[model samples]
Target: MGLLTNLKDSVSRVTDRLFASEDPKRIGIYGPPNAGKTTLANRIARDWTGDAIGPESHVPHETRRARRKEGVDIERNGQSVTIDIVDTPGVATKVDYKEFLDHDIEKDDAIRRSREATEGVAEAMHWLREDVDGVIYVLDSTTDPFTQVNTMLIGIIESRDLPVLIFANKIDLDQADIDRVADAFPEHETVPLSALEGDNMDEVYDKIAEYFA
Candidate 1:
């Protein structure tokens, strides 16, 4: 078989397997700045024996733009599954375009972008309210998560009634404290992880799978 033919066959097999699953779920991975959301997304996509979907990065906000990757025909316990994981920008209290202002954006341009930022916030609210099925709220384990941004995020999740799995990322950091963050978001399930090191990824896999189940 040619390369293209082989590729088509693989795609067909994955599709068939996923549709055959008992229940399939699409998950959105989101969180605040520097929360390792991208890292976690990539880890989950790759760590599974199935096809890993997206690229992984170590830099904060590396995934300012949203990208999707798919895990093909992931079968567990005699059931086939597909994980549609979306890697979105880390939620921010302010528009990131503001950075251009300090970097010398023209006054008129900056003003218009500020307006756009407002619209972006609205878009984010809509996504939180209507779009996503679940969220993996990635928190920096080294910092206190009870801040306004986190609290506001929590409120939004609660309002939408979306199931959230707290991903306490950067557990490898010297100052990491998963316990403290766990205390802050006591209602949700928490998983300590070092996305770079690929630590505790199985737990994340199980958590996400549970949500779908």
Candidate 2:
């Protein structure tokens, strides 16, 4: 079966057998390294909801384990909807752990070890297909959104047939070009916004509500 069909079947089974009124929605934020995945997550967590993304900028792979913040509510069309935003690790092409061999680290350095493994972009794709209810694919508007990494990520999301919202973040930067970024996801939906400055965030929230509605 197709990925979308599989997801629908999974959701259907859950709805049929589990708590009927649960209505728990999972929102996943995905992007390549330094594309502002955590920044956008913090923006949504702070402005829309009281939840916050823990301060982990200097810590490598902080989001690799799927950090979740609960109790997010968005006021759409005069109604309130609860949401849970999951801040995931930055997806990127694979890197060799052999690169770290010369660092003179012991085998017990689990933190450093785990970082080397998650450097692969495929790991994020695996997580998305497994646990995501919807995706906000953050695009670096300052750079080429059609780059190999971004394109591959979008293709995987499409293959899953999941509802994806393209967030053209960093639009406030000098190099940003929202128009070009929007063009990258012509097949999926797109929203241009500056996640850092909180510009156009309401538009993002509205898009999210419509996707699940």
lDDT of each: 0.69, 0.72
lDDT of 2 by residue, 1-213 (tens): 377965775586445434534565778888876677888888888887766785545333445556687768878999776777888777767644454445554545644655644743455666687877778888778888877878877787878877778888887888999888777776666788887788898888888776643
lDDT (10s digit) by residue, model 1, range 103-159? 467778766655564554455556677666667788989988988878988888888
Provide TM-scores for the models: 0.71, 0.75
In model 2, which runs have C-alpha deviations exceeding 4 angstroms? 1-21, 56-62, 96-123
How many clashes (backbone atoms < 3 Å, residues ≥3 apart in a chain or on different chains) does model 1 have? 0
| Candidate number of the best TM-score | 2
| Backbone collision tally, model 2 | 0
Q: Report the lDDT of model 1 for residue 15.
A: 72
| Cand. 2 Cα-lDDT | 0.72
**What C-alpha lDDT, on a 0 to 100 scale, does residue 106 get in candidate 2?**
56
How many clashes in each structure?
A: 0, 0
